[model samples]
Target: MHDTGHNDVSPELDRRLMAAGLRLGRRNLGQTHPNPAVGALVVRHDSDGPIVVGRGWTAPGGRPHAETMALEQAGDAARGATIYTTLEPCAHDGKTPPCTDALIAAGPERVVMAIDDPDPRVSGKGRAALEAAGIVVTDGVLAKEAARDHAGHFSLVQKGRPHVTLKLAVSADGMIGRREGERMMITSKPALTAVQAMRSTSDAVVIGIGTVLIDDPRLTVRLPGLAGLSPLRVVLDPSGRLPLDSRLVTTADKVPVMAVVGPAAPANAKAALIESGVQVVETSDGPNGLNLHEALAALGEAGMTRVLVEGGARVAASLLSEDLLDEIVLFRAPVVVGPDGVRALEGYALSAIERSPRYRQIDAAIVGDDLMRRYWRD
Candidate 1:
């Protein structure tokens, strides 16, 4: 919400710029982990309309930021042009020079930004530097949309934890599976494809030991071109009970997998898991099992900004019980599973309806006869 100066700018133009930035930023979601994905666009005004001179998104691995790339494309023509970016330009020197310096040198007449960077080093300094250089700046344009686009980065900087999402597919009667140890395709093909797309955006996908034992899922993105963009696979096995021949362990050589264990886990079992190329980390234990908060803190320290929890009941219940869940994605099929089927949530029982956690529905859509509902914490 920082402002350098105000001008007679068109609101429609601001919306168009923000939308463009958002579209570009989403191109490299999984590739940029610790760093935020940003986009920049350069515009020049004419009698007819504003012409886009250059556009660029953050590069892979987070170096050579969007502002620098867009400015370089504009070159001498950048002078007197207006720059629109999804995030406030960086004001500090890190792996590269400060982006604020690049924008200043480019001599943009005005800069319109969606949201200010939450990093302390560049929060307000970027805007301050631009104003000092006699540039007009307008921030907080389409700010809410920008925040949703960069939720992972904002969560990491402000809350010191990864943005957590719980994903599950249930029947019409709210049953996760018809029987225990049964590998069933609960959702349709289109819903499965959508789930794969979600996996490609997350930094890591987590499951409990029960899921590992029952499903034996590879937990990789299998879409046409997104197979290589699979996220890191994480398993919460407090007692080190995960089998060495599990799919996650077998695929460790091709995809990264980590096992979170408790201090009291068997030494031989831990060593065997490590021998299978699975990285192991120990955390504190709670009455239910591994301390979920401590494990998430470890992941945050390791630079994980977002986590998708594809659960087997126990894991979802534990995260909800600890008040650690941030979002929920429910894929509801039209089929019905009777009383004998396994429920979607277990272990956490609410004593009263008033004590239940509240969430607001953000989106709902139909995917090949299945209903996909998205909700966020209220």
Candidate 2:
């Protein structure tokens, strides 16, 4: 727990507050994209100790921010109380009134924020506004953790592209599939469930035409109650190779599907996809295929803040080759596939080890017989 040198709040209390805020904020992950999930807690001090007067987390779909909800619940008790929030309260009026105004109106004696919102519209304005109102403000408490929690939202704000995560389930020998014509089941039941959880939270799930043709994956969240939360399904079919009667196209009415293709794709194929209710996005051509950067920019413009790339080798190589991937979630099963098996990545080469992209290992855990490893770009 990093501390900002502004408030007299005890170090222990600050740690507890930041921990509580982070817990609350995580409850809404995958539910809030474009807008960072935030958590707020209002506490008052007494002889015994500090007691929480109110608490709130950002709601699903990112409306009525945490500060607003907490202040509403605190009512008059908010006066002279200390506020602990995971992210800086917003000062802009995008979907709601400025949270700074709400905090000021509630008369909180001190405000503790974990990380500054990266959006230029409200980056430092919220803290400045609170300070101008004679309220004590402390920032950068558990700042790194808060930033990690909202990396997707921050990436969209800063880079104008959705935060891309490449997910792969490979064999112990690094093979994603069995020999050419063989059916492959590399992961255990628990790992498949974990993939469902990932899909439920993402703004979109992306794959290449080869995957669509071979696996014919529904790419929808299949967890009991989370089925309705399926994310948008995106296909990179540069040559319009996706079939018209595919499940993705047929189910477009229920869950949105986007077919991204290059300009040279057949016009008839584009019309067929559109008729099937799939949104067809045509982008410029790259040396290898459709321009991935342009495709990501289109997704960002359409309000997607996070994307899960479930690959068929070529697509994974393309994103990695272009340096567009931000994170990687690898599920390694205990089984070993031989050299004839399909590789997880293809066509990515580096002359020297030093020139290769590096990632920091964030976590590793066992799920059933499989090992799940998470990494972020260094």
Candidate 3:
């Protein structure tokens, strides 16, 4: 904890408290559906210096919000203390009472928010309520970092689209796989594990029907002790041609699977997939195949905030061309796959990606023998 007095927080202390709150907010980032993960901290001052009274993150299922937990833990120590929250306290009631009311009742002397909530019902109302109750309010302390943590929720609420992450593993020469459309390991084990971690953080992992038919990809998180965190597997089988004996179907009972199909899909295929515990969603066909916009909208309606597009080039090109992708996670291997190999982003111009203004590189690192590059839309 950083030292500070009542109503006299320094910039350094503000960053430290806000950073701690943001870290706590990520405890359940991919697990909280229909609600953004939030973190809160309660701090008090004494002759010795400032001390942390309590801290809490949003609960797993969105009930019993962070403020409630922290306030309960703080007890009488909360009076005249400062509360640091990653996002503005929610003012609207859903499964629980308004958090602003709880904060007001706690008799906190000050409330600091990393960023205001974007939900219309709580955007500015939470701060307004705090001020109305005579509690000092601070806004936008490390707002950018808070927004990054809340990206999925914001995308769903503001754009009616789940945050899409496009993952591609290519060789040094930009080839994605070997000839004949076989499943190839472009990156080594560590990079594969990193990709699995990415899968664990998403609500769903998407792939085109071609990938299913050719690669028969399982698309599940293979990491030990974290298999339960594997995201829902989504395959775009517009023609309803997915193989029933595939690994995805065999494990549908263990992990959720959704097949997005076109309206013209054969009833028999759809029924068989449903019989195997697969959730079949029907939408119209786009210029490519499945209407991705409608498919993503349906997912957002299902309360999925984030989805990973682990593709077979075609789906990736479609999502990129249609401007649906929100982020990119690329793995580049050191070896070349030669001219006989499958190229990345088929049917899309490389220059479009090279010169695109909407996306900016956010991070790059070496994962074992492969290099990972991540980008975010501006």
Candidate 4:
């Protein structure tokens, strides 16, 4: 519905080619959930003209990604065919095997890839393998849209954690808090619902001490028929400064983990939170308040591969400055906050900023007085 015509191209041909490409893309749905969705189409010219011979996409359980799935479906017909895929076929062996192997086995005459993977493991290895195998490969066709669709997957493949995008709604001119000391509800009900869905899909949800103090939000999935389907709640309290009466400490039966920034938590405070069923972990700070990168490494140790960060300005800015953020989800409400409140990102040298943060817009729609936009890092 949004204007996707920023590029010059025929709508009809784009639709058909995307359709052909999408046909092969569905095969990897099951395995690629937390990974960039991959789709591949095998085309062959016959007496009837150019016809799709096979197709495949990433499946669940994270195995047999697009290239592999397409090869499986294309089989013998894969030989002497052109393969159109959303990502450059993977070159490294992960989960099952390298996608490059499958493409070589299929013997496709040429490969048309929309985007190149930035993951260190497969950045150019996949393409290199195809080239060495004597297969023709053409890169950058419909790369922008494809990247948008698979932003999260690529970020994880590249950084080992889901991109962390912090979304907040404030009033006109930048006031998160009102005259009566009440926090304003800037996002609409529909936007909140969308965020709930986002929570459901993520492996974990994270917050800072500031948000915990102000909102005391439960940070759980609360959609229709999804009451208890919530992500793990992570708190970054360097000094174990969470209040004793905090809802997170009192209400969680799931043994929520608290990440603190130092040696052992205070004996009494630790006893109180631990008795309340929270896991207190002490970590060192890397100059920033909580030493975010170390926190992420600890998360990795805890088996969290993807994390969604929801927080105030300080936490978000820290993550961005350290290049620890993987993605960003922004909710633009009708009410504009002015200069008194906090800015989205703060305290970074503008001239030093490189690696221009790239995001693919996933959703843009109005709900009540709010406009929600979901984006993933590229």
* C-alpha RMSD between model 3 and the true structure: 2.7
lDDT of each structure?
Answer: 0.85, 0.86, 0.86, 0.65
What TM-score does each of the candidates earn?
0.95, 0.94, 0.95, 0.69
Model 2 Cα lDDT, one tens digit per residue, 92-134: 8887889998999999889999888889999899898998999
The sequence of per-residue lDDT tens digits that candidate 4 reaches over residues 140-180 is 67777676556556555655555455655544443334433
Name the regions of candidate 3 deviating beyond 4 angstroms: 1-6, 349-351
Which pairs of residues collide in model 3? none
Of 1 and 3, the candidate ahead on lDDT is: 3
Error of 2 at 157 (Å): 1.3
RMSD of each: 2.2, 2.3, 2.7, 6.7
lDDT of 2 at 188: 98
What clash count goes with each model? 0, 0, 0, 34
> Residue 93 of candidate 4: its Cα lDDT?
68
Choose 2 or 4, whichever is better by lDDT.
2
